[model samples]
Target: MSAELRDRFFALSTGGAPADEVARYLAEVDAVDTEPAATLDGLGISWHPTVRFKAVRFVDAERIDADVRELFARPSQEAPYLAAVFVDPRELSFRTFENIVPLDRLLADTPLDLDLTRRAELAEGAYSFSLRLPAAARGHLERLDALNLYVPPLNSGSRGGERFIFHSAQLAEALTKAVAKALPQPLRDGFSHVNPVFRCNRFEPGDANFHRHRDTPYYDAERHHVSRYTLLLYLTGGSATPALDLTGGVALAEIEPFTCVIFDQRYEHEGAPYDDGRKVFLRTELIFTFTESEVTHDPEIGALFGKACYWTGESVFAPELARHADAYYNQVAAAHWSALTPGADREPFVHKQFRGVHFVANGYDFWFAKSDKLSLAECAAITLLDYFNCKLGDTSFRALCQSEVIEADEADAAAWIPGFLQDKRGDSAVPPIDKSLLFPEPEEANNECCPFHSWAAFDATRSEDVIELYTQAQTFAKAHILPAPIVMLGEDVLLDPDKFVIRGNSIHVLGKESLTPVNFAACWNAGGLPGNYIDIAATVDTAHFLVPPIFFTESDDCYHLRFDFFRNSWMVKHQQVTIPVPMVQDGVCDDGDPYPWRYAVDEVSLFTDNASDRGKADLWWVDNPAVEDEMRDVFD
Candidate 1:
């Protein structure tokens, strides 16, 4: 069982049902000394220690019939739960129960007329006009009405409902037969059975209000089997009717008594608040297995719950998930709206290879049915499409080009977005680096921090301007302290003008002036400076170096030693020092590193000739006057 279902199943098992129902359910749980199992037989499948009484009493025959047909017509994903509930099943005889009010009696009490002004503007009619209950079915309806009904808590805040049930074996048998006969042959074969997960609602001037949301949870990674249909039965009537949104489009309908609307639970819908008078209704789910083969012949004990699934009804509130869903919908199913409209004049715009395109969003892969006749809007309404469009942005809802996607199989498709899985590309992709090998181990903290860029001389044709920039850099460095700023004066293209910017927590960079505002908060959170930077006269021998070469660590985290070919010695920034080695070690750094040391000119003497070499010699690392120890000896 999924965490979601486990939570819900326990919630249902512990509370929300009649006392007897709860007791019976618990008894079954106690009886199961082993693993939880369902009561399976040729008669039909049901949960063990089942609540025996039928829940729904009277249903809007016309409305429910239409829903049943529509449900059977669509794919499995669309109708996760289509339901119908029997309302007032009062005991009329020893064997069966009867509905409190007959259709004629109901009509006499509450007459309905299709006024143009009052007509529901929804895609499907608001009030069911086809409420013709057969004469033979009236007793069954009464028996359904006599059933002990239970209404679960509608909202977390409100408390105004009751749960009840009186099990009747005769009624269950009759209702089961009716339900089986009602389904088409194909659906009957595939259908497992229906269980009583019922709800009764009382709509008053202040109480009848429900937000728009999808029903059953959507499945993504799991292979869980959940109920495929949600059955609803309306049993009361009043002057005020709530507006309902349907699959095809928005429609206004009456919330009159005996009016039930069964639809795919995936459809994103809403129940408009009601105000005029009191009304009551009952609802139930018609559960079906996803495939016919899932119905096993053996009727032994097994798992009570199947795999877990998740609902995306509340997903619209999440921005990231919504954005991706919108993109997927636009890429896969946006172009097929015209074909789904009842009387739209446009021809069926068919794309040969694009029919099976799937939108992979938030882990779920949404693919159109084989017919490919459903409208984009319809598909979007059921899936996460509208949430994306409403919150993220509008999706063009056009069919993607054939070249952009590849069909995986009969029921699956994959879109070929560029850069997706680009890392896996062979020759064209950047070669992977073994990150572990690139950096010193965490234990070697001193060796794990290295200079990323090198010291450069403050250089400029106008010596005064160079001096001014160097002074500014020094002042900034003094103010910010640790991770002393490395000042570079050469015209390196990488440094387009000099300005300070924060990169991570407490880590700032004197980057190009064109870069965006630095996130100082991020820098402060990262602690102090990343590494040290220093300004020197001229690191190389060039009289007018166009760009100063940066002496940085091979890796960001590692402080491992590297030979600076220009300086000709082992280089690791500890407290900073200069030790000249022979020129034979030039290019001694790793060959695989993209930034390799290159020699400028070998065999240069560090012995300066007085003041002329004064400014330029600053590029060479200097021993700290305070530390009497030789810097080279520390490395040894």
Candidate 2:
């Protein structure tokens, strides 16, 4: 404590303003103690201290601690946890957090969960690494100015200096408190109450870019301590550069205030450099290990949690959803919309060769059954398309679909895959998608007004702007040719109907179900010919041709269910069904995982118009003899 004001603060403490008040003040001072003092030395801890805007030495710890507490106690309009002492730079670097983490104990305690295995191989793998955020938490992480730290030598001829400030205390405190509360148990003890490893970093605007590498808990070359899951909390500043370019991984943008980019360390990754001036990103990373044994799972273990597989209603809030519902709607409208709304352009749908053309949208399985075997890539693709379709409507939506994406598939893969695989093309971080799987058959869209750029249009199509989607779809399936379909036991779906679309490219189905009042599908075949159909399927997504047979059943959770492909919105259609999740929960796995699911879809046949005497059911069978043989081979 400085002698000049040491006596003043000391005088206040001894003045006896109020007995209770004195006690509270002292307790507040005590709360921040020992930790900061220890940070100075004794354990190779790297830290800087300040008292009343002045950098102070350890001898003045009491005064420094008291001042910081005083600042913290003041109420702010924003979240309190956000209020913090920001070092000039923003980085979560603290010595205790790094050296003392119980790596071995944590690893031994946690288990590799097999919940997803039970859910289905694909769904299980995607959900294993995916995490969700509560609405408030997500909001807090997306908003601004927060505290950070800074330290560096002075410019030439200037005196060396060190300082810190409250970048945005309100925002910082909110983040700190939210994180403290949201952390899983193992993490709570390591952070909020008492932390063993406290490595914090102050991310300033001038930090060097990161090499594509896994984060390591210990500075060993092996980097084995890279935790299975980690959260990079952004407190302040702007950062970009080594934009996270992990292959097949969720592409993460630079440090944004309030946002915490959670990720798996096993993936190959990089953080863009801090090139923006003066921005500070107070960053913190929390990693924990868990195996199958630590947490146990039981059907109805705790209070029976409610889950909805299909959002039966609408509200301002985001509902849970499947990955393909919205994309499916766009694919349908791309080929069939003109039939309902004359002159609608649909070149965008066929050209992109969306990853999953024929897969059932989530609403179908969500309301009718429960299946999580969807891929993250498919989910993200649907999400982007869903957003455009909702905000832009048919014209702009079509425009965007044809407009060349500014970035490449791999460029944005971080959000979809673990980083271990991001491979870039040339100097750009995004790599072009191979066009092999995405193409149309020979005939293409027959709409006379639609632009016919060219057949085998490679260069322009490679960019895959909205217009090119039409070209790609044509390459996949024209009137003259169609790709073979995948056949499995007990089920057969028409890969490419000989007559898909009647006028432009479209497939016509019988039954009022396809031509509901909403007209999501073109089922009213003006020309009553069983062989006439629209060629609307995208090669990348052959399943695009058929909507799942909608059925309302118990969504595991036993909630009321509903699904409509046109109601495409992120998380809007998702409903959790808490059925009997038969996961590999207890015997030898990480039990912390939520229950997984397994599902079956079969007996698919198209409805056809036939008088009662001619057929038992008015329908046409997709006679792929190969389908029956395949099914027998698979499940036999």
Candidate 3:
């Protein structure tokens, strides 16, 4: 009620006005108290009176949600925040909706505490002095302008038997609608539909490190091309949080207060932890659907979906033999898989299985059994491949293409694979890689040379077996590496095997320092290792996904925006699309220094792109739609 109006009620009733006049005053409260909201236009204000208490709330919960979603979708130059305040339960007198007899006595029986003594006083020497309640809410006075309250029952403010209250019926109706969603009807017999309830979520400390993962939990991969928005609500402040920017992600919208962050969900993300305590929020989800009836209409969309279907697949791997073929393979070595336009000439692959294949194929797996000399070489190869995939997906590669995108030039890209990839930097006359080189430094540092690359290395006995996979991979790579309009590759070089480790199966022999991979991928193009090619955290693990490639602003930063899949990473560069990724040192290279070819990027556990397993066999299966036909055809 308006303060002006509320004053009137207390004015007449406080000191006990005459009995006859009391009836007149009660009637006044009734009229305003039971008032109905005018319309949706009056959404900002509302009140509803049950028998004894007035239930109040904002009438436009729906409006607020929509607006927040819109705001979240906007990209902002400022750090965003979204905050909400909930009345602390310990402070509120929730007598209208819950069983409160026990609580009432607890307060009544308590000795006068400093905070409440002033408000709770009993008249001296009276037969039964009336008890006054203390103010029971935080930030209550400041928001009284937008407040709702419930008053107690008649004559003596007693309990039970009474089953009603009065207020703006609009308030009552709104709560009914909001709470109704959390409950199902017919299953309940009473006014639960009328009672108001809200879920409480609190943030607590979670796992330590961040996990980079890409997923579409709400929609089917094939049917939905994009989701419009994501809303994350905060209930309280705390230290731990799970949210991060990963490669291949861009803000189609934004993040901020009372804001709804709407972005292209394809951008991979990570759930990072905040050191400070931040509370968990009540989360709401919404999706804009097309064609409501059975979700069917045209066949063209079916084809588009089929082409883009890799969005749902789990990434797999080919042997590492091809990954170490110098710089070209180094890039893809870190990726899950390479995304390529089907057929020659960058065709969109009108076939269902080809669309978006690169991203789906990008984030894959390669592991080292034990640390040893052979494993390091194998890891170098496999890791480089994954990296190549990530590099292609990143902004670094996008900036390289001229005319620019390789997605349009399949032939040069495919043909350039071997020689350019093997050892592009052996020549000394080549220029050092330019920050603006866009493409990996040497044209020759591409996918050609096939060192003993494999997480498991060349088990002398299995050498022949590994060779076949390498040959196939090289062939597969040649088909997709496009002819230039300036082809820039987005890829990562994963060091998943125990590179140079002194222990077990992955012993990376600290042998003759070989900058072969670096020379091939970067310098080969420029004809020499770039003065400052980046080094990312190329990890290796045996049991957990051996190596997961994620590009970062700083080579060691795993929390930056990452591309969890190869397809998306490949598409971004190959297609030459602009997206946000951090920019590191961009000036002249660190003065003609050799690339840091051998470095220790710890074994990290990546929040793999794809879906979270809710506990099933295989955790992932080759048959998953994202892979299946697409892999079969590509591998063939």
Best by lDDT: 1
lDDT of 1 by residue, 140-228 (tens): 34334333233342122223333232232332333345456554454465454444334445444665345444444221112224444
Task: Report the candidate with higher lDDT, 1 versus 2.
Answer: 1
What candidate 2 gets wrong by more than 4 Å, as runs, is: 1-206, 218-226, 236-242, 247-257, 274-636
1 or 3, which is superior by TM-score? 1
Per-residue alpha-carbon lDDT of candidate 2 for residues 1-636, written as tens digits (9 for 90 to 100): 222233333344334587776565445443432223221111211132222121221111221233244332211224333222212111111111111111122123222221101111111111112223445544433332321222221110111122222232333333345555554454354342211232234334554544344443211112212133344444444645544455456554554444445444444455554566433333334433334453233322110111111211110112222112222232332222122222222111111212222211222221111124322222222322322221111111222222111122422322322221122101211112323333333232232221134323322212223233334223312211222111011111112222222222221311111110010111112221211122222212121212212223322322122223322211222110001101111111223211111110111112221222232322122132332333334334
RMSD of 3: 29.0
- For every candidate, C-alpha RMSD to the true structure in Å: 30.5, 30.2, 29.0
- Candidate 1 clashes: the total is 56
How much does candidate 2 score in TM-score? Answer: 0.22
Give the TM-scores of the predictions, in the order they appear. Answer: 0.25, 0.22, 0.19
Better of 2 and 3 by lDDT: 2
Q: For model 3, what is the C-alpha lDDT against the true structure?
A: 0.25
Best-performing candidate as measured by TM-score: 1
User: Which RMSD does model 2 reach against the true structure?
Assistant: 30.2
1-636 per-residue lDDT for model 3 (tens digits): 444344444355234688877676556545653322221211112222222223222122332233232211111112012111111111111111222111111123323211111111111110111112224322221122121222222211111112112122232233234333422243122322221121222323453332343333233334432222232333233332324353554311122222212233333444433445432332222333434453333322222232222211111111121111121222222221223223333422101111111111112222222211222333333333323321232222212211101122433422332232233212111111222222122121223222225323313212332233333323322222221111222332223222234333232322111111110112101112221222221111111122223332211211111223323222211111111111112122333323221111101001112333323323122213332333346666
Query: Which has the better TM-score: candidate 1, or candidate 2?
Result: 1
